[model samples]
Target: MENQVTQLLKAMVKPDYTACSYAFMQDGKIVCADAIGVIDKINNQPITTDCTFNVCSISKIYCTVCVMQLVDEGLIQLEDKVA
Candidate 1:
């Protein structure tokens, strides 16, 4: 799973300024985690798990989709409080 994640991230990497990181959790634990590309072009530094991204509005899209999926599956209600 870790190898697959690394390969996927490598394929997703683009341009000189872009990097991709992915982490998959199962049974309340991370099963695969990876970082690819460089965050700093000047120093040729590699991206790490510690790196923070200014995701802008991208997270909103993901959250909305996930919530809607749960709603459609009857797993959650829109008015339900997140406990």
Candidate 2:
């Protein structure tokens, strides 16, 4: 079942988004958790579980705050390329 979940994540990559992380639960417990695809096309870094993603509208605030903090620090610029 874990292998199937992993394969699905791999198959779902590209064409739309380059990478995704997934967790499948069974009976209120996590049965499978993993990530697939390169972090970006340029660096080709593998997406790790430690990385955070704003996957839905409910997550926008957290991502927005992180981005805004980066902007304030000038670590990320308006001209920066985002993946």
Local distance difference test, each candidate: 0.86, 0.81
Q: Scored by Cα lDDT, where does model 1 land? A: 0.86
TM-score of each: 0.69, 0.54
Tell me the spans in candidate 2 whose CA falls farther than 4 Å from its real position.
Answer: 25-30, 56-83
Q: Which candidate achieves the best lDDT against the true structure?
A: 1
Alpha carbon lDDT at 65, candidate 1 = 100
Model 1 C-alpha lDDT per residue in residues 1-83, reported as the tens digit of each score: 78977987787787754688888899999887879999888888889977999988999999999999999999999999988
Q: Please report, as a residue range, the 10-residue window in candidate 1 with the lowest summed lDDT.
A: 9-18
Q: Which residue pairs clash within candidate 1?
A: none
* Model 1 CA lDDT for position 4: 79
